[model samples]
Target: MINISEIANEKIKEMLAAEETPNLFLRIGVKEGGCSGFSYGMGFDDEQHEDDKVIEYSGLKVVVDSDSLKYLNGLEIDFKESAMGGGFTINNPNASATCGCGSSFRTATEAGNPAADPC
Candidate 1:
């Protein structure tokens, strides 16, 4: 299960309020081709595909596809507000390496595996 901090909930709420769709979720996934060979993908999704493991926290829906769930399960998500500005950050114990930009990551076992970005 993934945990979401209060800050993360607030940020998600703000995003949800701005969306016109009634059904939405914070969708997380992985893609290839960051400096680290794989990168994290995060965004708002309104649809849930078959085989997605959906979790709810603070009235917000969070979805992880079956494939990405292995790499993202047990993650702790929070909203960070520092001099660098504000954004949602994922503390993933599964990540073996992170890119220089800090936005990309790859797991030890899955490193170098090519998974194209859907976006």
Candidate 2:
């Protein structure tokens, strides 16, 4: 299952409030690209597919597709504020290797094709 920290929950709620759509749901998935072959993707979605898995945390809605769930299951998302700024951080137990920027990762079982050279 995917988990969101208290800090992230608050941040997500704030973000959703700023959106034009009142019923926006946080969607998390993985796509083929980045240095590590797979990159995490998150955005506000108002639509859901038949195979989507939906859950709620701190009253916020989250959805993940079946395919992406394999890579995102047991994922923990947190929010952090520092001198640079504020950002969301993902701690994924299923990732065998992650890129320098921490947005891309590869699993032990499959390393999908990268869009370009490693960054």
RMSD (CA, Å), candidate 2 to true, equals 2.1
Encode model 1's per-residue lDDT on 49-93: one tens digit a residue. 999988878788888888888777788889999897988777888
- How many clashing pairs does model 2 include? 0
Count clashing residue pairs per candidate: 0, 0
Best by lDDT: 2
Residue 24 lDDT in model 1?
Answer: 76
Residue runs of model 1 more than 4 Å from their true location after superposition: 110-119
Which whole-number lDDT from 0 to 100 does residue 25 have in model 1? 80
lDDT of 2 by residue, 34-104 (tens): 78878999999999999999998979999999999889989999999999999999999998888889999
Give the TM-scores of the predictions, in the order they appear. Answer: 0.84, 0.91
RMSD of each: 3.9, 2.1
